[model samples]
Target chain A: MIRNLQVAPDHYLLELRLPAEFPCPEPGQFMMVRLRGRDEPFLSRPFSVHNFRMHRGSVSLEILYRVVGKGTLLFSRQSKGTILGILGPLGRPFRISSICPTVVLLSGGIGVAPLAYLAHRCRGRNAGGKRTSIIVYAGARNAQSIVGIKHFEAVDLRICTDDGSRGFHGPVTALFERDLCSYDPEKTMIYACGPPAMIGSLARILEATSFSCQVSMEERMACGVGACLGCVTAVKDNGGRIRYERVCREGPVFDIRDLAGLKTDPC
Target chain B: MNASGTFGFGEEFAPFVDLNELGALVVKGLSWEPRQGNPPPRIIETVGGMLNAIGLENPGARAFIEEKLPFLRQYDVAVIANIFGETLDEYPRVAEALSRAGGIKAIEVNISCPNVKKGGIAFGADPDIAAEVTRQVKTATDMPVIVKLTPNVADITDVARSVEAAGADAVSLINTLTGMAIDVESRTPQIQNVTGGLSGPAIRPVALRMVWQTVKRVSIPVIGVGGIMRAEDALEFLIAGAKAVQIGTANFVNPQITLEVIAGIEGYLIRHRMDDIRDLIGSLIEPDSLEHPHEP
Candidate 1:
């Protein structure tokens, strides 16, 4: 069961008590949720792993979400201590090894959910003298949309709002594009999540610069467990038959290079 | 309990029908997080059935637990948790979570989801994994587990027997086969998910066949789903060896179908002077065997 805890008005962070000794969800991994209340329109909604904590008997998942539809709207109205029905650790998680030292986490809007977890995972893994610098480039429609970065200590966070209300104007891409030119493409692996177009648009720019990035794709899924194939992304396999990729099963997290024809340019 | 993907669990249908009056209300599929589901134009209408690629857009298991279940508790229906996963491990983790739920009664393991990019077919299409998933869930929790089978498999019977052997309390069928509708004029698939599952009258015959095959192979009661529209349609399943029936596509057309079927069953019982609804179950006869197979 997940405990629906309110964060800010219209924003909520859901927490679930997973069984203890279960496998830890990877950084970019995600879960699916169904909001309570009769007024909610959508039956189920998906969110990336915000973070997790292991206890003596159970592991818990923390996911942050904003009410956008019938699902979130109802969720936001929920008071703390409200319980919800949940399914999770559903999709594939981002792959991280001890060797990948310098990491860049990117997001558009609330795409920061998994990226925040990624930063936490990376920070936890950084050993003596390894100095895994975490660079965050978050894009939002406005400054109010920024999330979770105020508390992160080790990671350097940059904000880009479309309206130029705060921080850098233009897009996160401007910041990301700037870093891409100066950063060591080989040592640093890019972990990204959010809406498809933002990821897709940035993917195009990344392709032009030969920067390797791993992307988490978003699809409206019915069964986040993969059998529904409702959350599918097109990918040109090695032989190049654009087949349907079930985001719930294979990934919400996938290798950007592997998505092939679904991504623009040589990517 | 209903299956995932085909129906958005019990949420959408509850509006038009009294959810608690039904036996159990199974909700939609759960992942680890919230999903946006498929792209635009997710649903497409056909002659008798509808094809959808609405991808399992859910709020992940955590969200469902935190935000969804409380609302479901408002209704008096037994909440059946419909969980899906990529591999054997996914089922147990979800089941364990659902086990802790306050109002949930049973867990419906969705063995028939066709939406995920990978790890989906490996479990649903394979008898070993299907059973393995059942075993895993049964071991993880004390709740009754129902393994919902997909119609896309080569041998639905083999999977049914496997789940039964693996200690599943009950099993359900048939989940929709992977399907698609193309917008020929636009030269693209009509559904955003590219290929969605096929449900409704188009798949009734297939569902009936699978249900017949499954019940014959396993003693566990089979809950038949797919293309169930009316009480007679529900009756067809009851006669075909189903102990109960799940109304899937019909909910979209008529949310009251489940109640209608329940009323229809009562009417049938009263009209025939049959004492119990069980008397109407497993009425399939092949002439060679006039005796009831399940009779004590």
Candidate 2:
């Protein structure tokens, strides 16, 4: 661990320096982290990669987390030298096809962590001659809850706070609704990660739209691996039949359209 | 073997593990009909363990035979179908369904699920019902029958004996113990289900003791389960008289843990100059039984 600092109230950004040979995680892939030598919180907590840098002899990855419960509260007090049992790059990552000319990244609260990495990757792809534009819509309860805004500096940024303390006074999806005319729905792909309510509303708004969208879901996960079957989300198969899919394995990232009538409550 | 419900019919971890290397693979608990399971917040991490209330959610036995069994048939691993029921009659029906499926190596009667409202732990909690379920399953199938006993019972040996008397080929001891966790600030249960089954390192000691007692009391082989995260934990169970062990909660932490455990046990046997791993079974020395015991 190198840096552990508060990026917002109750939220902290942790930078872990892993071995040079550590496999790099793709955008939207998450890591399961637990404090070394602690079993009070028996299972490791999952966190999406916020940023990463592979240097000459080391690889450092950043994780943005909030003190939502016991495991995270312990994470907030850890110092730079604390050892954490890390399991990684788990779950399916966000898929971006080159055919899509525009990518819309939407996030709520700490969900911004993975989208930040996704935005960075989009910028890198664009630099490599792929004609793609990036737009980020970030929403939070208040200014203090806003996170990862700086990572989206190069993209068109739209910020929304529920209390009207930030850029857009309404929900972030409203901005996407207002800007719907700017891009061709056929050429655009929207990726969202956040509270179920926010994602649910976004899904509802996109019902009549033709833009393809993917959502990164959050569930109370015990094992960030596929074995547990603890973190499952209901998804519709090709036959329009519902089946419980493990979020830790098959995906935390899934096509919004594939989720037929997803429940608004956390699973 | 990977315990029921932990390995999800053996398809999810196929990329991470070699199913052929396992002694057996116990698929998730199958029922007469598809079960939606408990509501959200079905699992939560506790001190040195985790609690789950999955309620045995499955695609039903017919769906299992159609969708999952064929995939499992590709592997050399002994596939054990862990069957459960919502009522007494459903047990034989589930077993008979698997019996006609033609590929399963054995049938594990799951009379130990604590998450359901009926016909699960309730059946395992009593000796007569446990025996009846075991007898019905045994009559319904020609495959080897293994009765998985719940640790939630007053005396697991009683349940073990009943299953043994009912002609069960073997028994799997120590299913998850019923437990609960509360969120202080929210002033509510952490899991949506008021109570859940606890399994992990925290429950290992209790499971071992139960396995030991059951081993001493019954004539059948015991498959020890509950928090066998490492090879050493499994060895403890083997020494205490378990014929085999099942890896459960630890599979969540590390998908390769089962293979690691197999390697570790092999290493220990090689270090001890043992040709066969069976030599270590029930090899514990009882200090009290020795004629000239050292007073410490």
On lDDT, the leading prediction is 2
lDDT of each: 0.73, 0.87
Candidate DockQ scores, in order: 0.04, 0.53
lDDT of 1 by residue, B124-243 (tens): 888888888888889999999988888898889999999899999998898877788777777998776688777877788899989987888999989998787677888888989999
Clashing pairs in 2: none
Worst 10 residues of 2 chain A by lDDT: A258-267
Least well predicted 10-residue stretch by lDDT in candidate 1 chain B: B1-10
Chain B TM-score list for all models: 0.92, 0.97
What lDDT score is found at residue B39 in candidate 1? 53
**Index of the highest-DockQ prediction:** 2
Instruction: Give the number of the best model, judged by TM-score.
Output: 2
lDDT of 1 by residue, A1-267 (tens): 457765545566777776576568878887766654322232457788888888777788888887765456766666655666555566778877556577888887777777888788788566334768888888787777676564356788888888998788867776777767667766777888766666666777776665568888776655465444455676667786555566777877887766744433221
Q: List residue ranges in candidate 2 displaced over 4 A.
A: A19-22, A55-58, A81-83, A124-130, A181-183, A236-243, A257-267, B100-102, B270-279, B287-296
User: Tens-digit lDDT track for model 2 on B115-219?
Assistant: 999999999999999999998888899999999999997899999998899999999978999999999888999998989999999999999999988999999
Model 2 residue A74 CA deviation in Å: 2.9
Position A204, candidate 2: lDDT: 79
